[model samples]
Target: MSEDSPPGLDLARLRTHLDAERPGLVTGELRARVIEGGRSNLTYVVEDGTHRWVVRRPPLGHVLPTAHDMRREHTVISALGPTPVPVPATLLLCTDESVLGAPFYVMDHVEGTPYRQRDQLVPLGADRTRRIAESMVDTLAELHAVDHRAVGLAEFGRPDGFLERQLRRWGKQLDASRSRDLPGVDRLRERLAARLPPSPPPTVVHGDYRLDNLLVAGDDTITAVLDWEMSTVGDPLTDIALLIAYTEGEALGDDLSSVASAPGFPPVADLVARYTATSGRDTSAMGWYLGFAFFKLAVILEGIYYRFNQGKTVGEGFDRIGASVAPLVARGNAVLEED
Candidate 1:
């Protein structure tokens, strides 16, 4: 691997670029602070005098192919601007690598706390928790309802091999990022390969639709649906399955009497029922997608395990990530084998 072009951002260069691009929008000393949690992209909240903006660029050291494309991320969010879906208004996109070390873009900085710490979620009580959960589901539905062609996303992800690419792509990612040997991953891969889910009409799929990925406003409405780096044209049900996997008996922990068990959540069955009723899409192959969703997440977390072992990641809980794989694989297989 080639040496990375240094890890820190060059503020002097960034100030010069912003001056040429927007002139008076940002003036004075540019303060750069690093934000955590992103593995593929380097994000920073750039504050200049009275103005604040967000910048997203490719990660340092090494990056995966087709990952962290700032232009693609800018395009999708900009396209979604006119839609009812909530997203940060993208201001400017710069493909000129000379401006910064790598391609980066600027957008309006949204002010809201993200719910990443499981213990910090505050439960929001039972009723509000269910409302927030439903809003998350509904927001995803709205995204899928948008016409890809009309929204200028017709050339997005390939529609033909949506499911196949997902299965193969994530499977390959696991192989690349694996730090330790886990036999269940192989077994799950074989089962998925043997009985691939039937193809469905492709719709917009948020590659990582989950609770933490969204921002909640009052009345349980989703003000901003973020992290569109993985958004693509694919089976809409795939998004549903991803959302369910993030919630189903997981967020609330082993005990069912937690905040996620409120009346509003509607369980997995109810969530799917509501989604099918709202979209009028076929819901027959939900089981396959649900299992596939877990498989994909397991692969991703395992990658985090790899990074953690190498001392490249922050936070705790890397060791226990491997434990979640077996259960997820079994759940996926059970869904496939069920009558």
Candidate 2:
């Protein structure tokens, strides 16, 4: 695993926090095994004898506002407990600043391998890969099916102007954090703004829905959909668009490697068809949504590049991310112009 943080756990701080959260459980020596993969947060699998827990806190270094909100992270998973969505049970949230210099939350450590790149899913046959991909869709469908009001998510995000706010919010992030100038960021933003999708009924939108962000069981099932930090109530198509973006038009196919190969997984057309059948939402704007997804990802990657320049992050192939942004903006532009 990538060493995303300093070697070994912060033994003193870990013990202190765990002591307050679970009395007497902090006794004896405690060792922390860091979990890698996230670019914006610190996840560790903490162990003390027979007890095991997962602690998620802010990134190793400074971060921007609206990024890495542990409270929001813990709240969404907690709210999702009664829902059909599979989520790790939230155990405790520590807002005290002194413990680790930032708020952190502990939840039951879930067991499953992360399904990120096409390489990870290669062991499973094409049919199994299709099943896994469909399970991811099904989980998302069920999440969208939940009653937001009944689940106490009425205040999760403002319903009105949901689409407008998202575009505006991410636009600001792009402007605030891009290391280098992307060729068509401004043009794509302008075009996307000019031709925004029609707002539909508000539903939970997993701001980031991709293969890597989810965990899969050996049976090719999505046991848990991790990373709820960016989740909010908004246009449901946004989530579908995200899936389209990651899968890059080959959503449910075989040869699941690099997200570029084609053949086995369901194609974007079919994936959208299945989702439409399950979600019962209008598919008229799906093309527009897919364009928006591509554009949004480009902007986010550019923002990471921006952060890298400020001397915040290093490595992980971010230096070359600027190359991906222009194409994504162009893709968005094409979608808008074609429609």
Candidate 3:
């Protein structure tokens, strides 16, 4: 490992593995740099001068159970490749921990932009931004429309009682990362539990679906959807609600992605309606889903905050993450009250 290589990735070992598994794939020396913006899994862009690919792995330390599963991420991306959903073609799945000190996978490096902030979209004009946002919704619909059984993912995830399991899972996640008192957080979780909405027919759910999670081309088309660590076979509405929650980024904090605030971006109602019209899924119960989305996000942020305080996080902007948890809890309570 070179002195300058990122913390988790060892370029020398990576080159050796690629040469053995997919010989001649790396024609020259491998070089890599951590790709910022992700707070959970570590993403890096690796190149051999002539060929480029993306690598994904678990965070440095303090990994929570069932989170950042490289195999799960690799499986979903590979399964969705044949569908209309745009996922980068997977090249390899390396589970050997000795290779990178953690499980990691490599996929073709895609060319596109992940619009993370309002300023990034302002230059694109409203028309293009609207088109990109709508395309994101439509692509999600396409993903939900895919038959998991047909995609060889019949055993991917447990869809039955998915909502219940999700609430419980996040609750446990909050418990695991409990560092300080987060007022109203437990109440928010209890309220969500008390009013769990019956999920519709299950589909592949993108656990974290938002504008920034997608890669948009110059023509405003979503080239690929990235980050599938939390994806599974579950209520598709969770995906919608999470996307809407991300749009409410003001309540979360400035450090979080808030591309929805950009000029020309479609309103949340329009995006919901577009999904309804595109996927034919009833969203009448979206109020509950939205509240649950806020709660889930709060727990996620709290976990990140715990990790940040413990010095387990990598990259900038994590310092501002802890401040968002309380606001998110407040937002969730407000949404449920309105509902």
Candidate 4:
């Protein structure tokens, strides 16, 4: 791909269509580049030499019908505009596949750093780091507090049987991509099924909530909570469990995406407590949720491994992803041992 053109985008055609659809949308020559490090959707930073914006589209080639719903992402961002979630301001959503070869949308590009490494946070010291971590929980509580019905998202997801559907979704994903025998996977899956906890009232769950997914400004405040591809109305505890599990893993020297192990970050209990106080949700049954989080992550990584095996994966780092599955399965089983 040339420097002038980003892969998966036809800038000339797109700009022409942009001007027709929304006049004056493109002030100058449009240029785009795929933002690296995103594992799922292809995110592009688009510019017109004056204003910058973000464009999101599904990855090229085969895709599941419901997986990369551009409309879903845009809808959620638009709904959360009046909420305290700090999502980027959405501009336009295009379902016309003729424009970008696939459905895509544009949003105002916010400035901030997604601190993915421990070294990046070390200079900030403990207090600032702790504040940032605390803010994450507060933001999550704020997000869960938003009523879907009030926000006109009552049909966003069927809250009934959410956990059961989630289990089946990941199970089928793992089976579809079972390239090897990960010993503890079946056992963990079975235990999760047999010991499923009754879910609390459904709230909008950010299916993949984590620190790196958020854009933090210099003041350590979250400028925008990016990435809502896995979002749905479901058990809010699932969101809490995932965050705790991620921080717990990082505390154990596991990098579960981001430098969550950095000094000054609050403990898992503290985060849960803050959420409980802020959102007034019961988290006593979190052990089961945390175990399920591990199982879900294992299944996800195994799928990536399967893609790598078929040589369908692009770029580096994929070689090391599949290896994390086994350990995650083991972690899943270990978490359940608390019961």
Candidate 5:
């Protein structure tokens, strides 16, 4: 192991375990570096000077209950591999904590770019950018159209009362990480609880869906849909609504990482229309879903803020994250009022 390996990953132990579990996988001395951009899970790019792979695990500390489940992420990706959904080929799921002090999994390294900011899309021009964004929406529709039962994911999640459980779960997460007062947060939660929209037939839900979560190839194709820590079988509309929130929300500010604001990226209404046309799902109750999406993002950012304050977060770009929480709460209330 190199002396400068990132936190929460011991290369020596990792290589030893890999050699024992899957012999001859590592050919040479193993080297690894942290892959940034993910806020909840810690991703690392490991290499043996011949082959490259990606590793995923829970954050360093202050992990909330039932959050960042490595087994769930691995299972979903593995299940969706045979489907049209693009996911890395899973190599191994390590549950033995003695190896890494936390459960982790490894998969083949995919080559693509996760465009975060609008400027990053500018170089691609409007036509290419539009094609990539539309492909993103289409990919999401394809995912919602998948038969969870056919993919052997019938027992993946409880869809009976998904919305109510999601609201309560995120509320509990906020309470667990409450370190500072947030205005309008209570009002937002109450409003959401008061007006629960009847969910359409449940489908696989990617709890966090956005452009940055997708890796795009040079041909404007979505190579893979990454980040499944919050994924499960739930209302499909929740997925699209969350995508809308990430695209249109003002909480993160203009300079923050939002490729949706780039030129030629479809607007919220256009994206919604495309999804409706493709998935044949009714979007009449999208207003309420959008409100809930903002609330969920606010709670997520607040949790990150708490972890950052405690010096538990491992990456950069977290300093301005705390300020985005109040704005997100405000946006949630505003969306509900407009609805």
Candidate 6:
């Protein structure tokens, strides 16, 4: 191991595994730096001076089973390799924990920018920003249009009761992550339960689809749709709803923390119209879907807050996360009422 390997990865053990698994993969000493913007998984950029690749693994400890499964992430991304959906080329998957204290996979690292904030997109100018945002929605439509069974992902998830299970699942997660009493969270959950929408035929769903999750090239094209930790073959509307909810959060100015409200980005309505027109799915019940999205995000933030309280999260930017959960709950309530 290098004398200064990052917290989540061990360079020495990684090098040994790479050498044995694929000869000549590493030409010299390996160095790594953790990539930010991902709250659930730890992403690292590894290099041997000349060659570079990206590595992904679960968080440090207290991981939810099924939530951060590296095998699942690797499998779905590999399945989509032949499709129109852009994904990094999967290189290796190391399941043996002895290699890096956890399972991880490495993929070809493509060069592009992940615009997490509006300031980053502002430099690209309004027209370019609009193109990137529109492209993001269109790419999501393309992903939702994929044939899951033909692509060998038919058993990825149960589509029959997907929304129902999702509602119940996030409620339990919220209860488990309770650092303080969230006033409107339960009401939002109950509202979602009272008005569950029947899902359209299932397709591959990117559980968290948004602008920042993609790598945009200088030409305003999305090079890859990263982060498949929450992906599955389920209700595709969940993807669309989540995408809109992100832009809504941006509009709320509550540190929903995405480039969804950037000056040049297309309106969320345009995104919805494009997806509905392309996918031909009924968005009449989108209010329900949007509510579910807000609930899901609120629960996700609460989980992060829980980790921050336990001192399990690494690095900066976590202190303000706990404060965002309540507003998300309120937003969820509003969207549910709109439904």
Q: Which of the numbered candidates is closest to the native, going by highest lDDT? A: 3
Model 1 TM? 0.86
Residue 298 error for model 3, in Å? 0.9
Against the hidden reference, what TM-scores do the models get? 0.86, 0.90, 0.98, 0.94, 0.98, 0.97
lDDT of 4 by residue, 60-172 (tens): 65454367789999999899988878999998999999887889988999999876677788899999999888888999998998998899899999999999989888888
**RMSD to true structure for each model, in Å:** 4.0, 3.6, 0.9, 2.0, 1.2, 1.3
lDDT-wise, the better of 2 and 5 is 5
Cα lDDT tens digits for candidate 1, 53-154: 888887553455566678888989998999988889998888888777689888888766555543434556657766676777778888889988898999
Candidate 5 lDDT, 1-339, residue by residue in tens: 347678999998998899999999999988888998788899999999999999998988999999999999999999999999998999999999888889999999998999888889989989998898889899999999999999989999999988999999999999999998898898899889989888888788888988888889888878899999999999999999998988875336742356776789888899999999999999999999999999999899999989999999999888888988888888888888898
Q: What are the runs in model 3 whose C-alpha is more than 4 Å off? A: none
Local accuracy of candidate 6 as per-residue lDDT tens digits, 1-339: 468898888888888899999999899889999887677789999999999999999888767646788998999999999999999999999899888888999999988888878889888888998888888888998998899999999899889899998888888888878868899888899888988878889999999998778998988889999999999888888999988888877655445655865787777788889888887888888888888898999999889888878877766688888887788889889877676
Candidate 3, residues 74-168, lDDT tens digits: the string is: 99999999998899999999999999899999999999999989989999899998889889899999999999999988999999999999999
Which of candidates 1 and 6 reaches a greater TM-score?
6
Sort the predicted structures by TM-score, highest score first: 3, 5, 6, 4, 2, 1
Cα error of candidate 1 at position 128, Å: 1.7
Model 5 residue 312 lDDT score: 92
Q: Candidate 6: which pairs clash?
A: 1-12
Which pairs clash inside model 5?
none
- Of 3 and 6, the candidate ahead on lDDT is 3
Q: List runs of model 6 lying over 4 Å from the truth.
A: 251-255
Candidate achieving higher TM-score, 2 or 6: 6
For model 6, the run of ten residues with the poorest summed lDDT:
249-258
Q: Write the per-residue lDDT of candidate 2 for residues 160-252, one digit (tens) a residue.
A: 988788888888878767656677778877777877778789887778887767777776667777887788888888998788777763332
